[model samples]
Target: MDEVEIVVAHAERATLRVGDVFLKVDVDRARAEAEAEAMALVPVPTPRILWHRPPVLAVAALPGATLGRLGGPVTGSPTAWAAAGAAIRQLHDAPLPSRTGRAGRSVAEVVAELDRECAALVAEGILPADLVARNRRVAETALRPWTPAFTHGDLQIAHLFLDGDRVTGIIDWSEAGRGDPLYDLATFTLGHEEHLGDVLAGYGPGRDVDLDVIRAWWSLRSLVAIRWLATHGFDPHAPGCEVDVLRARM
Candidate 1:
């Protein structure tokens, strides 16, 4: 029997690896079911669903290393990053999945969450008041209305799987839903600003990604996430991570 490796665990969800299979266990089975459905809906490659038995959704691990991770060296080349961007464009362009309890957070919902999280971060001294305030202002550009697209709600850098210059697959679709495409762009490139141009190049430059909105998302996401990360035994202050991203914006 293969030994089980704990991939990630938090209060709400956990992922375990046993050889080639990854088991994602979520408290809400609906989200797991949605992940499977979302994978089927997306145009890009996704992990093959081995089985989904309620709280646990098992999948065959895809080939290749993760594109990169926050606060770590990028293992992928420029071509690979561009390819990831193109994959994102393809995902965004795919037919809008019926909202049908799939996954989504309205702008109002997001604003409320951000506001609440920002207050806690400052109140708890997890982040400075001024830093939080500054980023709040920066985050405002993302609050307006946007034409909805099929968005990978949490497009972390580690989510994209690249084999050479080709995007082999993407993982984690529990957050898949219609949303502002810029949020996906912002999340994928978060903490890795230098790659934005390359990503946009592959995403198609003429499409016009407002730099300010992207910047706002960076600030908003960082500010909103700092407290949770700090609580969850992750460090937002690490080099090339969330805090650094916020400081750079100053």
Candidate 2:
């Protein structure tokens, strides 16, 4: 039987795998365009763009499995994680994409959005009020200004693919843009905090990164993402899930 896997399905977009091709369906044309353009600009390995028509994008699958999955133990070795980090650094050092307007979100605007989302979560009783409030306070540190670098705005582990210690490719460029460098690092290590040192080591020396701000992003992202995940029919309360990630910050 031919295999077909639903990679992700959410309000914004859906990604499916059929045979060796991955198809992405996005509701926003601009975001899809940005992703196409960003993939072209990034220096790191990326999935080959097979074709694009309106809402659907087709790309050839890359070699190797994902670096890890959310709410699960990382199967990839430390070397693979380090390789992924180095790849991220390489992308960060690359020149920014020409049209990055879609990636620009001011800290103030993000905080405002976070506040609104947090309020919704509290009102809906989706999470404990104190847990949400505590993480909200912790998230405030990441609201400061930063010098923008080319960032994979969503650098979750699953987006990174590796073969042994070699990084084969990175998938999901929809959120790629000029943004905080630490945001990428933070997002990459969201739930997998223990492996951060390995990533930082591979990120190499002399790059100034604020660890506290990175931690702040971890808190902010998990808290803000819970409602969206639940709305998308994902279980945020699973063991080692987003909710547990927030609680770990307490």
Candidate 3:
């Protein structure tokens, strides 16, 4: 009956610890789909189905620190970025059968939707609205004509787990879908551009990426972040190096 530490998972859902049981509550259908999709994609520490009647996923607790907490890639480091890119390529290259049954949205469509949301907020006199369209356009232009490959809808450092130079596993499959292979790459780049080239370079050549589409997603993500910060009364316009990159796009 007592609940343990609650870690953020997705909207309205938290991976809660109850005694020795790790229960992922909320949005059963989506969680189920993500779990299945993740199992098919990569070897990660995703939750497992514990009971179906009420829907529960039992996941092993990650013991090490997340890559983001471990000083990240140190900007221009080739090892971390290159390894990340390889992992993304491997993920994108995999077949996503789960997506076959779900309706998919293009990167542009997703960005446009986010733009509409931000515009609506502005109309309602909402301050600190996210305006990263310019940045989104840059990335989308690069990701256009995306390959018919699987995409990890939200591929960020927070969702990735690393052990030294190797990627131990990836988490959060709620946004997993089928689309251009470069979706993950674009996500990675938006957060780590200096090292993105390293990841891409290590992933190797010949695999075409839709940079435009990635930009669209990245733009949407920035807008989402802005809204999130604003809603939580956090700094919407933080003065950081990454802030400049994202702001320039807006």
> Deviation in angstroms for 209 in model 3?
3.1
Q: What lDDT, from 0 to 1, does candidate 2 have? A: 0.87
1-250, model 1: which lDDT tens digit per residue? Answer: 9999999988989999999999999998778877899999999999999888999999999998886799998877788888999999998888998753222567778889889998988888778888888889899998887777898889998999988989889999988888788989999999888999888888985455898999999998888888888778889999999999998888
Per-candidate TM-score against the hidden true structure: 0.95, 0.95, 0.73
Mark the 10 consecutive residues where model 3 has the least summed lDDT.
68-77
lDDT of 2 at 247: 94
Where is model 3 more than 4 Å wrong at Cα? Answer: 1-3, 9-11, 17-22, 41-55, 69-77, 100-104, 124-143, 210-216, 228-245
RMSD of 2: 1.5
The TM-score between candidate 3 and the true structure equals 0.73
Q: What RMSD, rounded to one decimal, does every model reach?
A: 1.6, 1.5, 4.4
User: What tens digits encode model 3's per-residue C-alpha lDDT throughout 1-250?
Assistant: 6668766555556677766556666566765556555555653344344553335556655443445521234432477667777777776667664563111465566657666756755676643344443554554454345446566666766666666667666766666777656656665566555565677777887786545455555555555465565565445455432344466565
Q: Give the per-residue Cα lDDT of candidate 2 at 52.
A: 95
